[model samples]
Target chain A: MSDGAVHCVVVTPEKTELDVRCDSLILPMYDGELGVYPGRAPMVGRLGFGLLKIKSAGKEDVWFVDGGFVQVTREAVQVLTDRVMRRDQIDRTAAEADLQKALEIKPTSPEASALRDRSLAAARAKIRLSSR
Target chain B: MANIRQLDKRRKSVRNIRKITRTMELIATARFKKAMDRAAAATDYTKAITKIVQDLAKSGTDVTHPLLMPHESVKAVDMLVLTANRGLCGGYNGSVVRAALQKRAEIKEQADSGCTSVSGKRGISAFRFANVPVEKTYTEFDDQPSFDAVAKIADELISRYITGRIDRVDVAYTRFVSSSKQIPVVETLLPFSGIEVPQDDSAKGSKIRDDYEFLPSAAGILEEVVPASFRARLFKCFLDAAVSEQIARMVAMKSATENAGDLIKSLSRTFNRARQSKITQEIMEIIGGVEALG
Candidate 1:
């Protein structure tokens, strides 16, 4: 409700993961990372599999957001993704195993390649976020 | 009068039936709670994505996606009927089948060809008995419908719509209004106009910020968002159907249990009366024998 603070909400298919007010926020866009401040213009960005950093006051909350879409409005920054997890939620061994499995897939067809690529990206993001 | 032993046997069977119905009622109640929680959790995501799609459609940017564009001429149509796989849920499956048949007839009147796909065994069997031809039948979905499972269906429908294989997609499902209320209805899913802007104060409050800056581009985002939203909507239908089926089963089983209780009570009353009458007859016979001997 304040002018200098940004409100962030992360929504997944299962539930609304988090809703909090923060001083600033960073989203991993399809191309790169984009930061949002209180007075940022409204925008919609495609999310990539990476960490979503939200900072309020001095503490920061990091979330591993799977690929989806993000909509930024004046009042709130909405992250619409299939899954969102904290660092602790990501299992390193499982993600690593998934990456290995994804890497072994032969891209024989276009659909297969797409599947392989998506899995590879997702697993890699999970591994990377969890390592941090 | 009926034999007292036969009456007792009937009463025992009724008591056993009551136990089974009561147990089923409890199971349905628990499942209903879980399913309702799942559906409630999905509401936020569904509402958010729908709102985004609505705002994009009303953004007036000449943004047109294939999913958002209506076909010029109606031709082939796809109807997906969602019913419970197992039937014990009173008229849940029946009403859904009726609604689906009604929708199919309406579509036939308007379209040249219609393809019917049904999920759940009850629906498939109903369609078969009705002599209606079904293009596909699915038995995988139960009380818990995963988003991925629903996404596969939505993707197939989307591809069909895009390739002009079908002009529109209609889903006949029971919409769960609350724990106590559910209504079976057919909803249009393609040419994707089902997302209506609510006339509530929230709609007025969240004015479609038309000045939205597209990160990559409006067209690119619309391409992804439109389909994602469509998938979300379809998935929501599955979730609602699941929850409603549980509720219907719970109510049906509760009534069954109550009716069984009443049946058992009446059976016991008759059994007692029969036994009493048998005893009185035996006593009368003994007294008559004594009088004859005297």
Candidate 2:
């Protein structure tokens, strides 16, 4: 938290992955990516599968996050997810294989469909992240 | 002389047992510290989720999550008992099983077809011996249970609960308070009443309820956050049970080692007395033989 930075905390059920001050942070919402600056109103939103792009000081960092939640206040953004992986950790080949596996499963119910979609999204996100 | 030899053998055996128990106690102590640290690390996540739930509750909106409301009447319930897979942990498994059995008995009339699901071998065997039918048994959850491992179980329970197949869910496990205290308690997991407002320094009385915005509606957020909170709570329970199990084992082994020490002490005392008596008898026999020779 400085003149033009917002503190960001990425939390998961298993562990807290990151806590950093950033100039700008983009979060993956249920529908699309949402960017936040230093002075944003407090809001809560559901997260989807994608890269969490963070630009701090002069460096850029990207992380792959599965569906979770984000609580963005004016001073801070708290991203809570069940899974978070660094950009370098994403494996493109594995993700492509997982995407194929996800596509093959037939969803029996709405919940199953949702789960399948999440897996599909996650696999795609990992592939996209790894390519970059 | 024979008595001294027998005492010496018993003392040696007791000393060996003491060595074993002392080693177990040291191992348990190390594990307990690690378990305690893991539990502490999880507390942050648990508390954060609890805070969000509390803020939602206080936001003055009509919260309408299925998990928040209790099912009508309760036709049947699922009982989950968590115990240690390995059994050197004194009464840790016993306390959990006893509590679970008592709960099973109390809910017998209410639940028509409830079957116990146990996570440890110790508990499953206890239920099996009692002739109680266990529907599921999971032995993979050891002293160190990963979140994914427990999440699968929680996800299953959540799905079953949401489907209305199971009216309620109860779990019996030992709760770790500190290094010295652990209480065995059976609590409701479904129709979850465990979510409470946190009494912490951060974010309490912030009065941000009026300014807060819930994206895609409050209900949509609840759909994800509620289930996640439930999963986290269940995971926390597993962690507590793990830490408590180590404490129980540590205490049990320490006492066993001390008891062995006491037995060795008494055996050595008896050994000394027997040796002295044998020496005195030999001297007397020599004196008698000399007198006879005279």
Q: Candidate 1, which segments miss by more than 4 Å at Cα?
A: A1-7, A20-25, A37-41, A49-66, A85-132, B50-60, B109-114, B197-211
lDDT by residue for model 2 (B1-294), tens: 677788899899989999999999999999989888888878778777766676676665555667778987888899999999888889899989999988888898777756579998988899899999999999998777888779878877876776667888999999987778899999998897666744453555554444678887776787888788888889989999999999999999999999999898888888998999888999999999999999
CA-lDDT, candidates in order: 0.84, 0.83
Number of the top TM-score candidate:
2
lDDT per residue, candidate 2, A4-71, as tens digits?
A: 88899998887778999889988989888899888788888888888799998778788888778888
lDDT of the structure predicted as candidate 2? 0.83
Residue-by-residue lDDT tens digits, candidate 1, B1-294 = 547778888888888988898898899889988988888898898777776766665554455678888999989888899999998899999999999998788878878656789999999999999999999999999999988678768967876677667898899999988778999999988999755554433546654544777768766676667777788889889999999999999899999989988888898888888788888999999999999999
Clashing pairs in 1: none
Q: Residue B46, candidate 1: how far off, in angstroms?
A: 3.0
Model 2 chain B: lowest-lDDT 10 consecutive positions = B201-210
True contacts kept of 2: 0.49
